[model samples]
Target chain A: MNAVVLSPVDLAIAAALIVLLAALSLRLRLGVERQLLVSAARTTVQLLLIALVLKVLFEHAHLHWVALMAAVMILAAGREVSARQKHRLAGWWGYGIGTASMFLSSFTVTVLALLAVIGNDPWYAPQYAIPLLGMVLGNTMNGIALGLDRLTLDAVQRRAVIEARLALGERWQQAIAESRHEAMRVGLIPIINAMAAAGIVSLPGMMTGQILAGAPPLEAAKYQILVMFLIAGGTGLGTLVAVSLAARRLFDERHRLRPERVGSRP
Target chain B: MPVLELDALATRHVGPLDLRIDAGECVCLQGPSGSGKSLLLRALADLDPHAGEVRLDGVACSAMPAPQWRRRVVLVAAESQWWHARVGAHFPPGFDPAQLSAVDLPPAALDWEVVRCSTGERQRLALLRALALQPAALLLDEPTGNLDAGSCAAVEALIAAYRHAHAAAVLWVSHDARQAARVAQRCLTLHDGRFMAGVPAAEAPA
Candidate 1:
């Protein structure tokens, strides 16, 4: 199969479709015309910049550059996770936990896949390592965010129940066991659903992109499966780390629930 | 000997005073709503921030781990929280069914879902749950507030029996003066952040 490259004029023609969608939203008084235009502009600029960076990265192929890029990605993902939280750990704790969890889960999983599973010629090859890391990190960050948010919220809302258990001579782990389970479950749900619906409900983005670039359908599906498994493992590990850390953070050393540590929220 | 002692206990809103309850003694604490009555109990239970020291039978609260201290000096809040779907799940393993009978609950009540339990049943069961731990001291906050007169009498009797058997110290918070008079060996009123000898004239029931 041969892939077709779109020139600038072809790209302009594709961009026209977004303008048409925005105009239709305006006509229907849907009130998202401005948002649609801003999002479209941002998507265009961000993707182009990322494309240029990736091109440069692939050409250079230095270990230090790869490490720097990975760090930047993890940091941005951590910030995204922290910003989505309603009740979060105070000060730098939320950001620190998110970044650390992603680094441990996604980075480790990606390295293992590159070196051991795929056994690529150069383990940190930007062509494979960067894209795979991006997918795993994205999913892991979401999982950590969801788990942390759920854990914090439950810690605050269910203080009475947790304390009742503590009063009953149960350890801190036993007291918040239910909440911990729930938070991890919430974190894993998205990935679980994606896994279940992968080929049938939707052709996943990575697989579709590969097939669009003229990779064989079967080859693309195999790669997609590997990516999915890596994502699932990364998410599970990240969520476990996040919820465990969060549950511990919600209490003091003596097993008292300190909702103040998460700071006050209405 | 005093089973529980608070040395100059001061929270943000109340205290900075000292008190003690001897073994087998039930001391009633009466105060208006939001006068820091619950806060005092919470502080005693090591659930709230406070200054000064709390000790159980010469063992400082700070000395023991929190879970151990909490087990010995338990606080039963007015609105008890039931986490498990089934009533029995909340209790510890090998908990005696006979304990439930002491609180006027049937043995089969253990199998009942917590959501199906009546407010009175929950109140009684919560008390039983606390007592089952064999705590040395109890910080009870309106333990029978939702109970009828007969249930209230039953709870008081059960508490009395337990206190006598174990020589446990109890800090019972109640708004009913007559109930306090009947249950407490001595009553202390929280007035303007201070513990007075008896119920204030305004708060004292006729």
Candidate 2:
């Protein structure tokens, strides 16, 4: 089969349409719709642009581009997610957690899926590396954002118990432990909910994509398992980065919960 | 014995509120509704920002980290509202929330789903969680405010047990003078964002 490609015109039109749709939804005060739409559109535009660049990049097989792309994606994802969660963006952990998560998940999936399974050449395969990493990093971004939001909100709601913990001589980290768990639950809930609703309520994008790409049902089923594992890996890594890594930010220099940063939407 | 001093604490429509409760003592705060009886305690805990200091064990709470300060100073509400998802899920490993049963909380409460808890159950559960932590000072914002007379007395006894076991000072805020007298060794009446400790010993919790 001829390699599938999105023409630049088609890509641009899709991007413009998505932006318009997001704007309209935002105007309607449908925040969740706006969040999903904007994220999807941004991901689409970003992936398509990177695809074009990677096509040229693969021809050269330069290691610098691969490393640079990974770094850029990590920073970009971290920054956007931290920005999205705004006030709750706790310290430098966002960077560490985001980077660690993307590396652990994307590389793990890449290694497992390719070396152990497909047996593809490991030397600079843009096709597998870029797309798969994007999926991992993108979902991780959302996880971090959601975790931060929930954690901070929990801090507010669970103030009494948290303070009680502190009064018992528990350190700031320990005091917020239960609250952090709440945030983790909040962060992890979507994946669990999605898993629950998977297949019956909705066909997940990955499984559907594999099916549409002309893979046989069993082959697609295998891919689905792999994707699910990767997603699980990514979610775990993301939650760690978001919850623990965000720890430094939750407590101030004196280990007290700082008043949240002003001017946050989340 | 340590004391909790809310020093010149003021917030929007709240306080310039000031008072102190020594270690192993109970100080009651009385005020009409919207008079910031609860708000004062919330501000002292630094859950909300206010202009003032909360001193504990002779250390200026403002200077100490809020989390550190909070760990030493706990607040229990009348209807303890901070209960989490599952009663058991909310507690960490090994703080046997089972002991809450002595306080009229169910033994199974530690495992009961949080969403199913009634208002009174939530209050008791929050208290249990706080007591489990064994704070140095307990700030009770009318912890029995929602219960009936008999239930209120039962909660008071539970608190008495908690305080005796821990030797923790208690600052109990209430609208009832009789309840205040029963629960607190000393009472501080709040009016117009300030406190009148009434008598010298009222500054001390027994």
If scored against the real structure, what TM-score would every candidate get? 0.96, 0.61
lDDT of 1: 0.89
| Best candidate according to lDDT | 1
Over A197-220, each residue of candidate 1 has an lDDT whose tens digit, in order, gives 999999999999999999999999
Per residue, candidate 2 scores C-alpha lDDT tens digits across B18-126 of 6767777777777787778787877766666678777888888777766657767776656554435677765657977558766677677787887788777777777
Instruction: For model 1, report the TM-score of its A chain.
Output: 0.97
For all candidates, state DockQ relative to the true structure.
Answer: 0.72, 0.23
How accurate locally is residue A251 in candidate 2, as Cα lDDT from 0 to 100? 67
Candidate 2, fnat value?
0.33
Give the clashing residue pairs of candidate 1, or none: none
Output the lDDT of residue A77, model 1.
97
Candidate 2 chain A weakest lDDT stretch, 10 residues = A257-266
How well does candidate 1 match the true structure in TM-score terms? 0.96
